[model samples]
Target: MRIAAITRDRPPHTKHTAEVVNANTVVSISFFAAFCPVSSRRFPAIGFERHSDEAKNKGNDFVAWNSLISSFASIGNASGAKNAFDAMPGWTIVSWNALLDAYARKGQQLRRMESLLDAMPEWNVVSWTIMLKAFTKEGQIDSAVAVFDSMQERSLISWTIFLQAYAARSGHLAQARNVFERMPQHDAVSCNVMLVAFAQAADPASAKRVFDSMRQWTDVSWISLLAAFARNGNLEGAKNTFDTSPFRNLLLSTAMLQAFAQSGHIDQAQAFFESMPEWDLVAWNTLLTAFAQAGDLYSALPVFRKMPVKDIVSWTSLLRACSRDPAAASIVFHSMPQRDIVAWTSILEIYSQAGELGAARSTFDRMPELDTICWTAMIFACSRSSAGEQALELYALMQMEGWNPNGVTCLNVLAACAHLGLVDRCQGFLGSMILDHGLSPGIEHISCAIDLLGRMGRLEQAEELLRAMPFSPDAAAIRALLSSSRTHRDVDRARRRARSSCSSLATIPLLSNAML
Candidate 1:
């Protein structure tokens, strides 16, 4: 059937046109169906399916069925490919390979791939590699190694696959090197892949060893090694590698700047910035992040204003830095080109910190959507600003709207209850933590509860609750009780309880060391 199609193009025979060709060879048939033009009257899809069915009727010849399955797989219809595999009367090596390839694309079909492999009458190198690659991609490295062990002929491809798999997992760096050493033929790619793996694992020593061992090093190898040094917080090593290089590349330089910024060497980072022959957006952002980390929001402002372009991270970093300084917080907040939840939350925190709950509430009310962090930020802001009533209201609304409170949220809400003298409401909030959220109360939550009880003159119950807790009382809890007692003039009782709390705390080094 393929011959007829080839012959027709060479010599125009009256009987040898595409019209006369039988759709018996499904491989050619499915391929033609995918690319061939359709008449206006006939639906292209229906014609394609009809040709596909004719191709399938060829009794699962490895050549024909492989092509048919590939046609369906190319269109991202895995179920259709599965159906085509099922209809095959019998299978050959090519046919099984095609089916396995289809199943590997859909990660959810690992069981199906395994079942097909188990039922196969014989195995080949291609079959084993397919299974190994599937397991490696799914992060099942142990299973991939097991398949490699079972292979009778170990090829370089097989060795490289396992090496790449270990490198990708990061935790298996030693095993990745073992495979690289054992490979009989070391190609450029094999060395490069190992270098990348070591780089990602933050082992510059191993990466440098691979770099030195390579007979030929490409631009890719240099970038990979430089990136490793950057990620491992080795800016000096990265700079040394960059300086000795015959070729200068922007990516390598950018990696060095990023490393310096991340490690908190702002002066060194600025020096690198000035050393750059030219600056790009990435370099600018690196400098911006350095200033943010240093808590020098004033220095970050000029960089933010001068950037040729800005992304979400740029805006968020500046906003967060501004949040720490109340005077500039609102200015930066209003000047943002685009605001994400992080930007909005930073502003909310600023207002909360400055004791302007009205502005903080206004910001919260204006937010387009409230994520968990946003809710937590707003709750904390109000709690600290002495607007506990507003904080409680927001907490109730959060629950009614189906937003689950996390540990931070629970701590903030408990603090609000303590600050507002909401004694009865505190018990209900505690019940909700156990019943609805199923979160165990941590020291922060317990401390807030103790403070609430002590402030309301329920000293006996608070002491009992403190004793009943699995963990001993924390410094904050003891201090809250003492403060409440001193205010109420219960000096005798306060002194004894204080002594007992201090004695209990001595068993833990951190608690005992902390000055109250």
Candidate 2:
């Protein structure tokens, strides 16, 4: 019963059981004794006891001794395994190998593992493999290579692990290719790793070269090349790779579908999606997201209704898809089996974005909880709908409710004051952004305050404020100045020309080959 209890591997519960386990007593010895009625050779991997020294002197329990050593080693207790080894009256090659394995697996002690390996009386392919993996785990690349060169024999797995170390390192592509060219044995995994490495580096031409040289291609080969082309924005090359591949699985199809969607080839994205022999929920969601991004709810709405399973992600995609249409968003909201905070938040944003302030307020009132983002979104919604005063009121209520405003929330409050041309409130919010919230006002926040000054016909104060900014004044601040100049119609043409030139330089993109 004690042997069964130990072998079951449940957590220690009672005091008696904990004492039995801690003592490492006859419970471990009994594990080997719990054999089948027919044969001791068929003993289960439970605990065991060492018999009298007389039995050890007689050499009758060699098999049981070796099994106990291996079992403890397998459990990662190096000290216990070593103690079991010291208890052995004789040793075999298997005992040495087991002890080596235990030492190798002891975490992050590479120097100790190397010393242990040096102490082994004899070594085999298994010993070399263990050493290779230990070195690989520590990222000791030079030591791994030295071990690889000294090996009298190498298996396919060993060779592949050696090559992968090079492929996994940055700026070591030449080394990886050199090793691949010299491989005496070629297998699919090793070949695919090189291909995938180049693909991950966004080198589609090099990847294709490797692909063409393969004696045969796996589905992984096809997927790697497809992903490489997609990442490089070679849509035509991606399609060609897809069409010529011998097989098409869901993963490859999804890769192509996403590539087309990101490149604004919505028509091709839809086509690839429909061509898949099987459609998982991810595929459906991807299609919905593509259509939604194109703002073509005419296609997305029908698909959402036909899905056999609708998780929160599916509904959220549809809600975000139909953001331009509050009525459609509301219909999806009412149909949810249950809604989480994200769902409630999305509906609130949809109503807010469409300028339905009363509808937004009703939804906000129904919310079971509120966070800073919810408060900010409502504030932004009010300003967008020309209710600047109401937006300010909500900001006050948010503060009273013990919700400290974040950078975005503070910025939205400033924008509301700007819309209403409330100069005092604008200055107060800008100061509060720095001192109260510990957030330095970014250029956009200052731009908003300057707009408030411009709208109030304080052109000179706005100009003075722009000159006082710690960083270079951006185009928005200059445009604020221009707007005030238009209000006055007294600024010189040369001043307007100078401001326009600054805006032009800031707007034009500086590309990599600008000197050319």
Candidate 3:
């Protein structure tokens, strides 16, 4: 009998044929044995041993042993679960599966799971599925496919997971669709995955087709389709879908509100928000974002004040709305209950945009942690203020702090070098951007380099760079060269540049004429 079935009213001693047994003693031991593994507080080694002794005395069955293993596994104590499994005189496939799950949940133990799978006397479909899931979770898609192919039998869950693996990748939508079509059956879950995938890709037409084909619709199906329309900027389609939904859930209502906001229909968004029976934090934030997007700070402030509860996003949204007034933005920043990196970066941008270099630097220094965005913003601020030397210094410091320069970071750095007339440094930085960082230099980057070269009187090199540029040089590049030519009194080169500019751009004619 299970220890849990025992009652206090039962006799302390019960007669069993020729022998008398102590029922209360048995109950006490068995109860602790089953309960110790699941206790909130960790038991000492002696406590575990005592429980094991009790179970052994009672000739504990497989169910009790499996329960013990699972309880330990549930708490993420893989070693404890292993000890329980080893202590058992014998184990069933269920016991082995529990141990495998312990390892799987611990993660980064794929090889250990593989070894255990090999050692098992036998495994069922559950075993294979667990291994497949482990592979997928580890991002070993190719290996997961190999395992799936080897499975003699696959469950619906296995097939769905396989589809999701492909769907989650950006360029693998085709493969995901093929899997969906090949499945022996489809559920709302599988259909929703494909619908969301297409929606994220901004292919609303395909998403609609999938939605129509579904045998049944879930709330997620409605929301995904609504989101698809919003993503595509089809506000009218979003409204039609919302009106048609039989259930007007809070989640669906919030999605529709977002659709109106995304399309710049602030009045409609406000109206829709007012109409909702309930509002969640996400809904409130969405309404606030609408006013911020329209630069309607006056409208956003009242909504922010009215919100009963405010989170970091709520505070950040209000900070963004105050972008035009740096003093007001500073007030908001100081008033935030807690500030995350986004909040910190927003305040930094406000100061930098106002050309307040001293205040910007102070804010940058006060940041407890720095990310790539924060670093780039500070560097750009320096470059814009013509503090080229300081910007370069920060760039070097950023690299030392293990933040790699992104494309925007590279652009700002090159501009700094140009402002300081560091021609050789600018050329080297441009090369690093391409070869070291694996970034494709755009036209703006090339223009900065050409301007630097022109400023340094390396006209021959500047002209060579312009000719060899992969992108057609814009007016700015031509003007930089023309200005340099006139400064050096190179009439012949100025005339040649004017003729070339006239052929490419109509607007360039006026600037070229002025330069000549």
**Candidate of highest lDDT:** 3
Report the number of backbone clashes for model 1: 1
For residues 1-516, what per-residue lDDT tens digits would candidate 3 score against the true structure? 111111112222222111222223322232233223346434444566666666566554666666676656556678888898888767666677778767765677787787786566565555666676667777778877877786777777678778888888888999999999999998888898898898788778989998999988988899999999988999888999999998789989999999999898899999999999999999999999888777678999999999999999999999888878889989999999999999999999888888888989999999988999999999999988999999999999999999988888999999999988899999998899878888888888998888888778898898889898998889888878777776777767777767776765643554455456
Clash pairs (backbone) in predicted model 3: none
Please give the lDDT score at residue 418 for candidate 3.
92
**All models, RMSD in angstroms:** 12.4, 13.9, 11.0
Pick the winner on lDDT between candidates 2 and 3. 3
Please identify which of the two predictions, 1 or 2, would achieve the higher TM-score against the true structure: 1
Candidate 3: list runs displaced more than 4 Å.
1-91, 98-125, 131-154, 169-186, 454-506, 509-515
**Whose lDDT is higher: candidate 1's or candidate 3's?**
3
* TM-score computed on alpha carbons, candidate 3: 0.74
lDDT for each candidate structure:
0.73, 0.72, 0.80
Winner by TM-score: 3
Per-residue lDDT over 41-97 for candidate 2, one digit per residue giving the tens place of the 0 to 100 score: 243444434422333454535455555655554455667667776776655545555
Q: Please give each candidate's TM-score.
A: 0.55, 0.52, 0.74
Write one digit per residue (lDDT tens) for candidate 1, span 1-516: 111211121222243111221223432332233223334213334555775667767654445566667656545456777787777665655556566756765565677776776555455565666676677878887777777777776656667777778877756878888888888888667898888887787788889998999899876688778878877888788878777777677766777787778777888888988898888887888899889877788889888899988887888778767656866778777877888877888788778777777788789899988888888888888888877887888888898888999999998998888888888888778878989899888877887888889889988777776787779777777777676666566666576676686664532342222223
Candidate 3 lowest-lDDT run of ten: 1-10
Which runs in model 2 stand beyond 4 Å of their true positions?
1-249, 399-407, 434-443, 467-475, 493-516
| Model 2: colliding residue pairs | 28-47, 28-48, 29-48, 29-49, 30-48, 31-46, 31-47, 31-48
